[model samples]
Target: MTIHTETIVDNGVNTEALIGARGAFTEMPEAAAFTFRSTCDWVSGTESSNAINGYFGLGQEHEREETFTIASDHPAVFAARDTAPTPPEIVLSALASCLTGGVAAVAQHRGIQLRKVQAIVEGDIDVRGILGMDPDIRNGFNSVRVRFEIDADATEEDIRALVAQSQKRSAVFDLLTNPTNVHVDLA
Candidate 1:
């Protein structure tokens, strides 16, 4: 198939650029290594704000067009104002976002024209774990579930494969499914 570098737009994604990136990564796999950074500051009682703007990827430093900030707060039941979703809620949303983007990108790459795509993500967590009420319970989600509703010019089997492929490629899914090493220290 003929590809136009500047004109192949699918699902609002630059397919040509994506293809170029795939080729580049295939040639120099190290370019795929990326480090993401975020800074969070305490705002008030159980409230914090996070800033995301810079990262290193494709063997170069990259900055976003604008800094994105998200504020988080605990619910009133937790003795804090319910002004914003808690950090756990943010995690759930981020997982949903990653999977949904992957689905769209995979669809575009496979030449599927999508009419609509929606995902509902839910995480089950026992607050007693975070509350220190149960030592046996983990302080994280026990499980996460995602449901996708996709309308596309593909069969149901194809749609299922698309979502499955998305999950297989999603970094967030891997992170959540596997154990990751984390270190916290006084700086």
Candidate 2:
């Protein structure tokens, strides 16, 4: 199939330039080698809250330092006050944002103009697993669902295709679908 390329400028994204960059990366794989790092420190005397800080650039360009706080608590069961969203909720937010970004990029690349796009992400989890009440159950979300409400001029079929393509290209989706090695140690 012949890919018709069009220049799309919306929301600070240049689709034509993005497609060109992607083609360049396909030719030079080393150009795509990027590492992302972040550090999270525990806040307060308890372990209910954490302060996360990280830079938001690819490769050697560290860019700017971004910081945010996350917390979790139970009303009376855990003896802590609920302040911010739990870490799992933060993961859901990340997934939603990543998927939304992918959708926007794909739409732009396809020459489709979008009026608005919204995503709702939900994950099902059983507290018993984390509480050790059910040893057979996993300690994380059993399943996740993402629903998108997109307003665009494209046909429904084309919109569905856009979503599918976005899922295929989303980095966060790949990270959640694939296994990643993580190591931890006392400092």
Candidate 3:
């Protein structure tokens, strides 16, 4: 049996010959790496679209099988059987985590040994407030109160100084209390 191949011709010229003549010179330029550095503009922005697969290291198999993603974590934890964690709970978690790390960093910097550090964070957000029913009431948490129990041997002054420094230096805390601008572009 004989096999036949068709030759590509353009204007009575062989296409392959033309391409070979062009060689590497006709190829497109090489691509370069595009690097970017970004900073968070919001202190307590709730992260969305993180596959509702459980905690760290848990794969998609653990995620919700339903089309309607179920909320877990804060307010959701406190809500009824069908509800999910609210935005306030996420905020409280961020603050609590920041405070814990800040205290630890300050103590480490000052050469103070920490026996234990505990914090109780209480935040109250009116359901109606979040629902946007009343214009006079705040939409978010009315107030976030934190009670810290430091077990370090350092004096009260030392603890106070550490807390102040942490509050001043923490990026998330600053974002929460300050104004931020957001820019968005669609391709």
Candidate 4:
């Protein structure tokens, strides 16, 4: 089988390359089957940091590693030392990064030169649920709001359409907006 690949460069983004890879995936769905793995190990006190390391491309042709640290703590009022950002903050960061990436990709694909793209993702959580004060409340964010500030050579309507396209295609957005099954077992 012959595969065709082309490169479309727009402000440092290779739109054709991304499109080519997607085409390849569509041609061979099995090639797109991939499992991302991560492990978090508790390091110190209950309120201390946890070392997180992860890798991608377990069943694919390429692989990469990412490592980071996260902390869990409560405010002084809760009698715990506050260190790094909490887990929810990390979730927001992930969402922001994913959305920003989508914007960049979409702009490149549409041949729009972007000067800047910023995404602000915010989640509102009611602490009563986490504190076990209200069983009816949820233990997660009640709502999430995402706002984008884009500077590009395109009309506002075009930019809005691009953002919509990005949101429609973003994996992270889908993951958060939809239901996913997760299984946990002792390793």
Local distance difference test values of all predictions, in order: 0.91, 0.77, 0.59, 0.78
- The candidate that achieves the highest TM-score relative to the unseen native structure: 1
Give the per-residue lDDT digits (tens) of candidate 2, residues 2-101.
Answer: 9998655364457778878789888886766766565565664334655555443323445446566567544435564555566778788889989898
Q: Write the per-residue lDDT of candidate 3 for residues 9-103, one digit (tens) a residue.
A: 22222435434544633452221122223222222323332233232221112333533332433343334342345556657777877887877
User: Which runs of model 2 end up more than 4 angstroms from their true locations?
Assistant: 1-11, 45-61, 65-78
Model 3 alpha-carbon miss at residue 69, Å = 13
Pairs clashing in candidate 3?
76-84, 76-85
lDDT for residue 63 in candidate 3, whole number 0-100: 30
lDDT of 1 by residue, 73-141 (tens): 999998998789999999999899999999999888888888899999999999999999989999999
In model 4, which regions exceed 4 Å deviation? Answer: 1-9, 46-58, 61-78
- Could you estimate the TM-score for every candidate? 0.91, 0.81, 0.55, 0.82
Q: What local lDDT score does residue 15 receive in model 3, on the 0 to 100 scale?
A: 35
How do the residues 1-187 of candidate 4 rate in per-residue lDDT, one tens digit apiece?
9999764447777777878888988888777776655456555444656555544342544433745666665566655566656678777888888888888888887878898998988899998998999999999888999999999989999999989998998888887889889888986
Error of 2 at 123 (Å): 0.4
Instruction: Indicate the TM-score of model 3.
Output: 0.55
Tell me model 4's lDDT, rounded to 2 decimals: 0.78
